[model samples]
Target chain A: MSTRISLDGVDKTFTNRRTGERQQIFRDFSLTLAPDELVAVVGGSGTGKTTLMHLIAGLERPDRGTVSTGGTRPRLGMVFQQPRLLDWTSVETNVRLAATAAGIDTTEVAPILDAVGLTEYARSYPSVLSGGQRQRVAVARAFVVRPEVLLLDEPFSALDELTARRLRLLLQQLWLRTPRTGLLVTHNALEAAFLADRVVVLGGRPAEVVGEYRIDRPRPRSPEDPELFDVHRRIVAALT
Target chain B: MTVTHPVGAEEVVLGGGRSPAPPDRPPATGTAARLTRPLPALLLVGLLAAGWQLMAHTSDSALIPGLGDIARNLADITTSGALGENVRVTLTRVTLGFAAAFVVSVAAGIAMGRSEWLRRFLEPAVLIGLATPGLVKALLCVIWFGVSLVNPVLTVALAAAPALTINIAQGVRAVDPALGEMAHVYRLDALTRLRYLWLPAIVPDLFTGARLGIAMAWKVIVLVEIFGLADGVGYQLNLEFSQHNVAGVLAWTVAFALVMAAIEYGLLQTLERRAVRWRRVALR
Candidate 1:
């Protein structure tokens, strides 16, 4: 149920509306994700980390090259920097909407809500939920779709540090339970180190992979692990 | 591990703390409270009616009908069935014209909102339509189509559509691109996107436009009827005017106002409450 994602020689550019100056974000950039692999893309601001996720999610098309998902197109579920829940819909309905869109049985929504610690809030509208709770709903939404690929763009960056840490753990636990081709784009080095199996540091104006680090530590790894700090240090260095 | 908080505190803290308790309900001081509860509006109406009656008594002018005479005339017309027939005819014209305007305005609004070229091309026409008076439009429609049902309906549509188009266009433009991206990534079908995303996004604006459009349509239809049509509320008012029957005119005008008030409060407000129940909860 896993799918490998590959972006080959992808080129994307945007022109300033007022200045008419074209800024190239990705030029001959390439990367590949092994099936069931969790890759975290870490980068500084404006390094096109989000654009890369958009490319893989098919929200944006590469200007010149192709982005393929190992022959078969996988059902993609995305979590944005904001929770992006439908404010009018309840938590359970939000998850069910994604499941419906993916053409899957909605029976999975209850379990996913439970998994994300949102069972009590299932019937509550997103507007009433805390920031952390809303993100949990988003996580439940992404998982309930039974997607082959999950793309998260700075999903926990907006939360308080304590809340973000807890959610990172929750996300890790979920990934351990049922692995998918996961791509997490974030600027937080520690978060990247904690959840991703491989950390890919992207840098420069026309972004390219500056360094790649593979975390071979086993599941349920501690955020406070000394080895994680070392890896975090190296990723931060690569980012600079 | 799950995050823990005091049982009921999470909702308060998370919901940004209940919007400051809604300005403490005024203390219920016995009969004073009960009297004040419904008194302000009723007192105003009562005062206005009493003042008009006094003025009619003092002036002894035929044009200034007292409240009693107007009520007697209203009862006469109601029993005679002219009031019902004319009301039905006018309501029919208003409904048809408003419906046509709404459908066309929504389509044109979405088109203009989505396409820059369409917006530029259609914006001038909408502005001109808004600037033109209902009387002018009514007269033009009468001139173009003669003294038929077409004049009132066409005039109402032309008068109401511009404001509705502007409202719906603003709604469409205000739709969040972030949500659009979320919809795309989730692979929501066209129908689902419209139902869950696009429709909800524009609902507040839709309600606003509907209220404004219906009010405009009512006004325009009455004007058109006065100028051209032979059998509607406005025509009845005109007939009463020609005979110098001020009581008859006032009765018809009061009945029309009552019907519009019913539609506004009983129908539109109820629908808007149901549609935007989430907003109420969010505010709380």
Candidate 2:
């Protein structure tokens, strides 16, 4: 039996008491995430794709809905756009924090840090690390715990183009290595097409699933691949 | 670790020790720049002292205490244990007041920062406290607790707490919301999250508030002491003024200023440097 996430009839809203303004971000939003499935959520900024993941991650609660994973509350792991690495902790200690939280041993940390290629700077503070290195630390922290589901919220948005591309490939490899459910949210259509097995578009004030596409491309995907261009076009069409 | 690609000519990536864009365009590695920078402050101190000594000699003035006279007075007071006793009283009261204010301020700040409703209601109250004249509060303290160390300490705490709370709440507010969400999803243990995430995020803010707390506490403490009590450096200066001894009053004021300066530059500066060494790289 593999892990699965189901969100049913979710409603979320926020009201400014002083201005008497109410913004309803999502109403009757529903989603079902398949086990070990790599899905990309692509949308324009402020589509509440991040908010959707927040709901699924339980960082937030929907004003209305029942959300579940594999008939239970599964462990959640996340990579934010900014590295969000704790400034005081070293790269290694940060990864260790995740595993230790889930009642794991210190032994796995070294290997996981090695996987992210940050073993050399294990004790270096986040302040000293480069932007790309910081994002790698974020990825390492997310992957170390081996959660039932992983959420990436524009995880490569801050990196330079070359760095982002490299990380995108590494993320593909990471998803392959673990049988964990993965949901990546991004505004970049090319990134969505390249990394995800399925693509989803979220938009509107009362956000609904606007579009969906499936990529039948092979592993070691090439940027020049004709099939990727087709998927990319469909995703771009969904954005506007 | 030494692997370096090309950085801009202006940027000193790791240890190259040059910064970009100061109009001089000096070789950042040159001793000339370093030598010129300290000259102005040195000259200013020198001139002030020379002018003070000159004025004292010309007027044969007892009222405008000369630099040497103040120094001798400091020595006399310290040796007689009068300075030490007064300092002990002032410092004891400051620490008690600051600690109490720190505790209350941090709790209220965090509460206000975390909740909009709480902030909306309490923010005005905090501002009111901050807006009220600190001496007025000191007067209130005298009325309530009478003329004692406790009264002054209470005055200082009331004056300091609201501002400290506001400073800290702004710091908490400034923290990236994504980090909070990330912490929750990572499921970091409460203590670990605090130590790793919350601590660094708030340390700069907390330190700022602590700095203000120390300053306000000392200032209010001394003023309250002078206004009500009959002991301490403040009161001694008060007594000196009553006797029409301007030199003595000037000497006591100098002593209090030096003490406050010493606390800030010596203790708090050292602690801040140690805690946030990362900032020095940029500032330097």
Candidate 3:
């Protein structure tokens, strides 16, 4: 498998102005994901999971060391925790804007919206939609660009279990349809197991990779499957 | 349509107790709703007018002219073309001043928002501008420009621009950093970023600043005209005041108020609604 995303010896630190204390989030941290691989990086809060995602997405540069995406600037798609849809535009227009920015044709937006089950609500404003629907639009926007790499920062964490599960399955199907390299930063062990081809645990101060698990399961794997539950257990054990 | 957040259902503020089931589709905002929406405001204005008329009848002084007396004078002044000429001059000065101020403030606000150095350098000056009253600015303008149209125009620009600059700078500062990251990740171009992210983030603030600026501009123009210039609404009011034409003074005041109201509610409000159509206003 070709390495699609690589971080070599990344160091990141933050200083608290009020307390006058410096905290390191990452130090010489390295990670790599194979092309078309979906990897979920799971860790407790403030474990630099999001910082890693940001580095891969090119939203931030490592203070030291190199971060490369397929050895060039990758066409990136990101679904943030919030919908982050433009409040001035309609749902359709938001997706279309992203697509147009990516040099994709506007015609592609409708089919993508249809896939996300938001066709009827195409012209509806973001404020008018529910949280799930809005997040779905955000997902559609990310996928509509046909990104070379997709980055998700706890996209489903805000949702209740049911909605999060539904969105997880939807995201999996969308990823399967396109087959792009993706990195998901999530804290849920079960979700990490369910959606990712590989689960990587991040822990310790100035976070480094603690454990990695490769799931060789087939698509449409049941959540109730004993093998998957075992994997979930193992991942949780790694987390603790 | 009935909308439920992924977390849970939001409480319905409009229907009371029970959550209002969202319609399957969005409702058509009908003309009837629009027309009746402002009825309460109209009724309140009508009540104020009735109270004023009642007081005018009860009082012995002609200084506080009745609405009818003001209306007659308004017609008389309008027919003689003084009203038209003065209004034209005042509006011209305001438009010129406001346009210049808008451009300058937006540019300055963006600069301050973007760069720490520029912000530090200009922030003190902008604060000084904000604290300085429009009357003071008008006085300075009159001294510099000597009763020319430039006097009111410059005063209005100085008065209005600072408020806009401050608000816009704060708006820019308040933009969600996460959204900026999203924009970068999506590889959105500068134009798209400006249109989708920056402007929307700043528009509510822009409107706030603009409304305040326009009001300031209106006041400053009149003040400058009354103090220095020999033309415009303030000058016309001065002429009426010297002759003790209480009805004319009230008439001109009403005319000025009407113009301000028309621009504020009619033009600015309509533009704001269009710009922020995506906002869900609370059900009144």
Candidate 4:
């Protein structure tokens, strides 16, 4: 009853045109996340990490079995690798778009922008904003929906180290403020260790869960914390 | 014309207000910057005028009238009120033709772009339509509609529609699948999907199609008018040609060229800026 997202024996495959090869991304994979648990799914580049997120988001359907969220169709929010903001519209309108699509009041737009530290940028177009700022707006747009299940696909991977660190902290704060069941697909073990209640490593040719670690230590745990560092090391070891 | 967005220029976002930048330093200036400015466009025009004048002086022919004679004819035509009336007639034809072409082509383009079945059914016909000669269309229109307002307008639309269709179809096909996936994930409504994802994705191609459509419309409208219709600048040009009034031909041409320039620089450029202003920032 507490499960927010359940993938039951999912299979996904894609074709390579040039080589005429069929690459299987996932086969007989299953994942279940409890409500309000932040799970970080980490894997190598081509190991079906993003594919898993896509399947859950319903952007990609499973070839076999089912990928169900909440009830029939749970409200979903996503922060892509790129900001994916509407370039023609202003930042406020971009956030407002998701809210509007969800039939949430326009009033939530201002406060969400404020929370993301983008109040001044509300009227500014996405093109004018820095990469980091654009990503922040995307994050704000994702959070505005108060989604039943939030999916992030390497959301901080594109940012530089300092900006990535800052955004990681920002993402944590936002998630804490309104805790939702979420899946963050990331390559960064440190990021996985810092954010997730449980870190799942996906590996092998047709990726399934290779390893899972419980970071039982409470959050607001520092990057410098010895216990957190130990978890980060174990996750990285599993990924390699 | 050289279009410059000053480094750190405050753009007008939604609700039409510029968020001011810090006025700490004056905009960047250098020799390269000054040379790259739009002033060079005027210099190019001056050079072209000088070349034209020199050619007229050397040819010593009635067909190639001096610039001065052309200017005088322009003034005479303006005072007589024929220039305005002819321009109005021509523009009306172009507007009707372009509007019709735009609607039909965009609808067809979207249909073809979105569906494999529709694309297969229509793409060959569309290609043949594009390859069809404007002169052929003009003559056919004249035969069908007679030498009246309908002939020129219909001919322009038929002649121009293919280019718009082709361009818009290509634009729609070129839409980023990543964005499409994003829209799907977010579960945006059809209208919102079109407005945000589809429109922005197809904009570059749409503008290209519009430019091509307008240009073709101008050419087709004038051709039909010159051959069949009794009014408009093209008809006047035909009349001047029959009368051997070379100066009059040049004068009418100048008037039409000026209007086209105004449309390009004044209207289209402004619209392009507003539509794709985000690109400027993204590029920087």
Candidate 5:
């Protein structure tokens, strides 16, 4: 396996205006997302999981340290918490948008829609679709790029249990089919266990990798499976 | 023709009693249909006319004109080619003034939005322009530029651009920062970034500013023409007023207002609908 992203000694400090104080989010925080590797960052609220993703994505410059990717920071696709579909476009147009921006051939659009199980509702607007379907569209759009690094910021944390479970099943199938390096940030241990190849827990003040677990589970593992439940419990304890 | 229903449930009959579903689209707007206003719009107009007639009756003098007499005077102006000339002058002034305002406002708004230093320097200047009273600006323009077309155009542009600049700046500032990141990751060129991300984000705001600009321009054009120019609807109104032809003055006023409504509801509304077709309006 080859390394695609390297974050070396990255420090991000944000100041609080009201208190006239500054908080160092993370100092010398670092991780690498390998090519075709699925890594889940498990962190408590404001542990700098998102800041790490931002540094990797080049959305913001870090206060200190080096963050670079393979040769260049490769194309990044993000599936944010909300669908973030342009309110003025239909589903297919929204999907077409990301692909069109890349100047790539649009052969992958149909397959992507099919992967997310949103092929039939291509003509529907985001407002008309249910929460689950909209989030699925966001997933489809991110996966459409076939990015070298795909950052998902709590992609399914907002959905109900049943809907989240269904989407997890679909996302697992997609991750298997498209072999993109996936870095998901979530506080949910079960979700982290179900989808990630390895879970890196970021906690304690200024957050570091407190625990790392590798899942040797088989593909299409049932949620009710005993082994998966055991893994979920261990990850939950780590998070707590 | 067999009009098929969705999902093999039922066959719906059309005007010809066919079973085909007719493609499940809104009916194409015919020319006559497009010209027709909704019942509420017609009622609004009727109420305005009724109010005018009632006021004229109560006034019991030639001072306040009846709606019919005003309508007749409007027809007289149209037939005599005077209304056309006056309308032409007013519209030309508005168009030129608004076009100039739009270009400057959009540029200023974009500039101020993108750069903090530029915004800090230019924001106070725009605010000064916005804070200046329209009548005061009109007087100043007349004093500086004289009674020609420049006075009206300058006055209107000053009034329009500041508000337009503020709104467009806010719109651009309000764009999804994430979208810009997506654009950068995809390496979308400058033109693509503008067209796909920025332009759409600001267009609704641009139109809003434009509508206000046009309205202000027309009114300022009239004021300028009444005081400065020797021709236009405003000047013609002045002439009617001098002759104590209240009916003719009222007539010209109503005609201009009606024409403005027509242009707004017809042209701008059509453009807005085309641009924002995906958005639905829930009328209560």
Candidate 6:
């Protein structure tokens, strides 16, 4: 079942060990996602985009306030900036491990691998796969869990332009097939506009939502769609 | 209207650039290349043997034993079955001591690596342990425990634990934080994290610590044996030295070294290769 995620009045701080400098990343910051909605968070470096994801994923706790998934502890699947696959494990085993962790059936692994076009490389190690292929396996791993909330932190930014573009389309397709609550944190405004049901731009010290835009376009929207460019332009303007 | 796109369209895009075929198989080597691989080590051993023989012939000193003399003494010990008994005794001591040291080091290493306060608290003890000479430890063990089995075993464990602890601590610290984060998000249970993530991640370090620990254990075992114990390869070495039988001492030393080398190459390295096979593929 899909789940709604909300972070209310969250506060987070990081202290530098060497310099003894305390930097506040989020203060009184809040955001929410409707059930089965895909929201992309776009911001510059050090704007707490990742911190926001971490707070939602329960990797970090807020100094104040609560991050709740509709009061239910929903299964979570995350795709990091790096593929972050276990190099020792096979592609199929990687997805199966996530499924096992989520208490889902391991049988879902093969179809997800097939969905990512990595069926043949199931037995191959992460080392042998190309960067894009490894990232595809990561996507398969996240989806196979049937997680109620999907968190992707700049999942395609490491790839070259062409591969990133294709993966963006692939991610959109996967989401369309099994829509769930999703948060994609990226610096790419165009990517945010192309994939997210809503694009929320975060900015300033102790980051807050600077702008929000809804993509009213239907599923399988083209990257080349002129309306996407207009939304991308507004996102970039908000970013500045 | 919703845009209708076929799954085939996505496949066409994904198929456009197949990643250049993975060089899954390593490049084949010629017979000549394979044959030459061990040539340097073999040549060095041969040269050293020849040089030692030449020295024995040139020098009439009783301390400089000839290769033939050493071989004859080695044969005498082997034929009398003393060699095997002494080797077994020494090996048992080393193994027990190393096992004890390994368990303590891994536990302490993980604790120190995971907690800053523990690291700071334990740093002085580790540094002191590392700085103490093996000979001093052996003498202290002899004084504390007398001429018994506990003397050598305790000395070996104490001497070896510090270096292994440092190695394992570094490994624990070096574990990728990203993977830990991934594990957290995935909700992997504690046992699963240890098995699939922590154990595999620290395997290289474990091997490093084991190798260092075993080597140090061997050295400390010998020291304590020579200092106090009545029987073992090291005690036999002391006996030969007291009798001024240089060849006897040299023969015993060579036999012990051969056993250590065999254990290292035959057991430890083979296990390491199997555990980290994924690394070999990644490197290729």
Off by over 4 Å in 6: B1-24, B27-35, B143-151, B199-207, B273-277
On residues A1-240, what C-alpha lDDT tens digit does candidate 5 reach at each position?
233777888888888989979988888888887777888888788888887777777787879888878776676678877777765667887777788776556888877877676776777666667788788888878878777788888888788766676777777766766677778888777777778888888887687888898988876555555665676777777777
lDDT of 1 at A223: 71
Ranking by DockQ: 3, 6, 1, 4, 2, 5
Q: Could you say which candidate leads in lDDT?
A: 6
Comparison by TM-score, 3 against 6, better one? 6
Model 1: per-residue lDDT, tens digit, B1-284?
A: 12122112122222232222223334545987756766776798799889999999999988998898999999999999999999999999888888889889988987887788999999999999989988899889988988877788888899889989988888988998888888888888877877788768888888888888887788887788888889899999999999999999999999998889789878998888778878777766
Q: Candidate 4, which CAPRI tier?
A: acceptable
- The TM-score between candidate 1 and the true structure equals 0.88
Select the stronger candidate by TM-score from 2 and 5. Answer: 5
Complex DockQ, candidate 6: 0.37
Top DockQ prediction, candidate number: 3
> In candidate 1, which residue pairs get closer than 3 Å at backbone N, Cα or C atoms, i.e. clash?
none
For candidate 1, the TM-score of chain A alone versus the native chain A is 0.97
lDDT of 2 by residue, A137-183 (tens): 88878877877888898998888876677677666666767758878
For each model, chain A TM-score? 0.97, 0.95, 0.96, 0.96, 0.93, 0.98
lDDT of 1 at B227: 84
Interface root-mean-square deviation of model 1 in angstroms is 9.0
lDDT of 4 by residue, A1-240 (tens): 233788899889999989989999888989988898989998887999988888888777899988877666777789999988778888998888888888788899888777777777788778777788889889888988878788889998898876677677777777777788899999888788888999999999799788999888675555556676777778877877
DockQ, candidate 2, comes to 0.28
Q: For all the models shown, what interface RMSD does each have?
A: 9.0, 11.0, 10.5, 12.2, 13.9, 5.9
Each model's lDDT comes to: 0.84, 0.77, 0.83, 0.82, 0.76, 0.86
Q: Clash number for every model? A: 0, 0, 3, 0, 6, 0
Best by the TM-score measure:
6
